[model samples]
Target chain A: MQRYKCIVAYDGTGFAGYQVQPGKRTVQLEIEQALSKIHKGDSVRIAASGRTDAGVHARGQVVHFDSKLQIPGERFKKALNAMLPRDISILDASPVDMDFHARFTSVRKEYRYRISLSEERDPFLRDYAYHYPYPLNLEAMKEAAQYLKGTHDFTSFCSAKTEVVDKVRTVEEIIFNTSDDELVIQFIGNGFLYNMVRIMTGTLLEVGSGKKAPAEMETILAARDRIQAGKTAPGHGLYLWKVDYA
Target chain B: MQRYKCIVAYDGTGFAGYQVQPGKRTVQLEIEQALSKIHKGDSVRIAASGRTDAGVHARGQVVHFDSKLQIPGERFKKALNAMLPRDISILDASPVDMDFHARFTSVRKEYRYRISLSEERDPFLRDYAYHYPYPLNLEAMKEAAQYLKGTHDFTSFCSAKTEVVDKVRTVEEIIFNTSDDELVIQFIGNGFLYNMVRIMTGTLLEVGSGKKAPAEMETILAARDRIQAGKTAPGHGLYLWKVDYA
Candidate 1:
């Protein structure tokens, strides 16, 4: 069997999640069904770099699958796109070395959260961004982000539902870009625990809104408890921006 | 009673149209219902600058109405917004002179059509932009726009259903701005007949795609027949960007 790597993008509004459930519609199920149709009824399973929750969109999600089909990369992309729904797109596909495992080989991941800071909620952006609708101290948020960077056992930043026991992860970068009335926060990390990005955003927003001080971040991280963090931001504002592989 | 003018923005995907059609959900119907709710079940009518087709969005649609309520404009704005759905937004509201009219007193209107130029259709922009996958000669489109940007009887560039007999209208400007795989075509004109902007865009696209010559626009304009122009572009990609009043 030949291994193929594909970059996928999806608007997750109508999806249950990235992973397949028995009856729920998901990104994985859609892709696998399309692949099965192409292979004439043979079951084809795909491994994604990670799963994103329902309503969390993706711009550059990476996945790998094994196939015996002889179609070239570009032709395969077109074929998959034709079979998939409008909300999902196969950005690119290529045959890869069998050594490339989508999950284990991923070197880093980038996630982006967008907030609409306008006083009035915009109708067009209601679904794509979190409506903050409050004053924010950018300097305070940046100060708190400094405490979030580097290696840490981010137990406070993840959800109680997270199954992974090893919570230590290296968050390499935390970027904040404010443009027009929208604020885009980008996080780059070797790996993130479930709901880590959303939790971090919620905590940073609390700091920015003066509900918490920048120094509180240090204590929150050291607490090593989920209760120490702020509320989890909504899934709709978050995007799986990119997944990088070595 | 005080005459008030309001600026509105809406995502038109869910609306039937801007006008009140019995048994159909329209933007005007929603606004009127909201006003009635605020007025203790008293029906209130409003006049809009113009009507937009179903799935045609608006950014600065202007409307005017007379109200007997003693509330301030800003407070009324807040009240209406609280009553309105998430798909429609009241951007601003202020008292206007009784002589002012939304449709008749408008000096000009600006409509914008966005076209996605990328070879691959992006899922995020599918509802907001018209995806034209073929290569386009922008220079040719601009050259054709020159012929379209003058006072002329736009019979060929409007829907056959247009009611106005005097089709003469002044198109003051035709501007093109291309950036990041999207092209925005803006038309600023004294007035537009029904489906005028969409038909003009379709005709211009034909010239850009080498299906028609730039000079052919002049002949089409002279023909004074709807069949002389290209197909009307889809309503989803059109925006009533702004309305100006003297």
Candidate 2:
């Protein structure tokens, strides 16, 4: 049996998320269905680098699946892209060892959330960006992003639906960049819990809006409660940027 | 009564273009409805700088409307933005002379058409940009754009649905820029008829792909027939970048 690893990108606007659900469209289901056709007469299931929320997009989402066919990795990528919808594409595919799991083998994941901070709404970027008409304090937002870096128990930044027991995660980098009327906050972490990135964005937005201070992140982390954090930013702005395997 | 001229931007994904149509959602109707509420019993109608085709987006669309409300122009901008749907935004509103008509007083309209040349699809940009996997000859495309500049009878480029009696229009400038993995064509013209911009983009694309030569644009323009030009490019890739009145 041949094990293949593929990098996928999908626009999650019309999808119910990455995971399969009854009576709902999903990125995983569509990919598996395409794989099943290529594998022929065999069921193919893939393990994703991470499951993103509905209306959340991905740029370099990695997935791995073992197949019995001896198809070349390049050809597999082409075949999958051909079968999938225009909103999804297989960027690259490669042969991997049986032990190489897409999720387990990942050492880090990068996510970016975009906020359009302009007085006017950008009609062209409506679906891809969160429109915030109020002017944001870029300096305050940048300062807040720095405080979120390093190892911390991010219980306050996670949603209530997160099933993970451990809340401790290492945030290697948190960068805030404000360009032209848009603010992009990028987070690189070992792993993220359900809605962690979105919640963090909300927390920083509060700081930018002068409702909170940069030091509040420490107290929020100590609270170990979801209610302590601000509301999660909308799913439209969140993007799974990349997955790194070590 | 004060007449206000505003620059607007919108993502055309959910709108039925800029015109008002019964039983269909449109950008013009949405703004009109929002303004009507602020006017309090007084009907508010807006005239647009250009008529964008369905699914065509805008970054700097201009519009003008009259209102009897005592709200300042800046306050009106803020009020309209607060009440408008997430897809549309009134960038700025300034009191202009009642005679400054959006369509009639316009000097030039500028548009930018973006096509992603990367083979891998971007999930986040699916609805906002056009993706073409095939390689394009940028040099050839630029050469064709030059020939398209200046005044000409663009009957071949105009759509069949165009109702204008006069087909002659001045092409002030046509510039092609290829940066990273995207190809962007910018067009500044005195006026365009129907799908003129999309047709020009398609013809240039054909030239870039070696399907047609750059010199053929002259022959096609001289033909003065719709069939002579290339197919109309998809609406998703086109954007009304700006309109210049002065």
Candidate 3:
């Protein structure tokens, strides 16, 4: 059996989430089903870099799977894309060393959150962007985001229901970009807990809107309580932008 | 009666077309239904700048309707948006003079067609762009497009089943803009016949791909037969960008 590593991209609008559910559609389920079809009904399991919540898109999601097929390795991308739905695409696929683990071996991950600043909702972007019509104080947001960088226990920034007990993680950097009617927030970190980026975005937005002070982020972090942070941003506005391997 | 002029936008991936067919969902039908609801069961009709085929999107489609309701003009936008589906949006709405007409008074229109040159299909843009990976000769396309500008009876470039008697129209400009892996073809004309922009794009693409010579465009125009042109480009790649009135 040969181990294969593939880069996948998916529009998360039609999916329940990244992982497989009992009866719901998901990106992993679709890929595994396509692999099963190629393997002549033999079920094959694949592992991804991580799981994304519902309505979270991926631009460069990494996955690995083991398969025994007679076809050449280069033909895998085409075969899988042809069988998969249009919302999911196998961007690149190739044989990988057996030691390559898509999840455990990942060094860092980058996520992007989009907030639309248009007073009028854009029909084309409604499903993709979080529409926030109110004007935000960019300086305040920047000041608040600075408090989130570096190492800390992100208990207050993650979902209270997150089963992971060890919430300590290093946030490498937080970047902000603004265009005509959109504000993009990028979070680069060693790892993120469930809903960490969304909670951070919501907290920063609150600071920008004067609901929370920029210095309040420090207090929220020190509290180490879920209720200390602001509301969680919607999943539709978040994208798994890229993953890096060491 | 108050005449209302509104600029509308829609993602055409869901609807059958712009016009109201018997049972198929359409942009016009959705707007009319929203208006009917606002008018308390009195069916209201709307006249648009023109009709678009199935899977054709619009960003600045202009429409006018007569209403006897007592609501202020500014609230009309909010009310219609509240009732219409998420795919459609009323961008701007206002009271217009009695002499203003949506269809008859239009002086110019701008339409954009997107052609994606990426070898790997982007899952995010699959519904909005035409994935054409092959390289094209831009100079040849520009030369062919030059022949199509100004006044001409665009019989060969329109659908053969078009029932319009006068096929003459003035094509003011055909602009090409390329960035990264996408090519945007913008058509600015006084008016366009059925399938005119799509057919013209297909013919120009043929010229660009070396399938047809740049000089063949003049001959195709002289023939005045729809069969003389190349195949019609898909409707999904086309967007009605803007409309202007005198």
lDDT of each: 0.95, 0.88, 0.94
Per-residue alpha-carbon lDDT of model 2 for B60-177, expressed as tens digits? 9999998877667789898998889978888889998888999999999999998988877876566677888797888888888888898999999998887998999999888877
DockQ of 2: 0.66
Predicted structure 2, TM vs. truth: 0.93
Candidate 3 chain B weakest lDDT stretch, 10 residues: B65-74
TM-score sort, best first: 3, 1, 2
Clashing pairs in 3: none
In candidate 2 chain A, where is summed lDDT lowest over 10 consecutive residues? Answer: A118-127
lDDT of 1 by residue, A64-110 (tens): 99999877999999999999998899999999999999899999999
Q: How well does each candidate superpose onto the true structure, as a TM-score?
A: 0.98, 0.93, 0.98
Tell me the deviation in Å of residue B228 in model 3.
1.0
Q: How accurate is candidate 3 locally (lDDT)?
A: 0.94
Rank by DockQ (best first): 3, 1, 2
- Displacement of the residue B199 alpha carbon in candidate 3, Å: 0.6
DockQ of each candidate relative to the true complex: 0.75, 0.66, 0.85
Q: Score residue A235 of candidate 2 by CA lDDT.
A: 96
TM-score of chain A of 3: 0.98
RMSD of each: 1.2, 2.3, 1.1
By DockQ, the better pick of 2 and 3 is 3
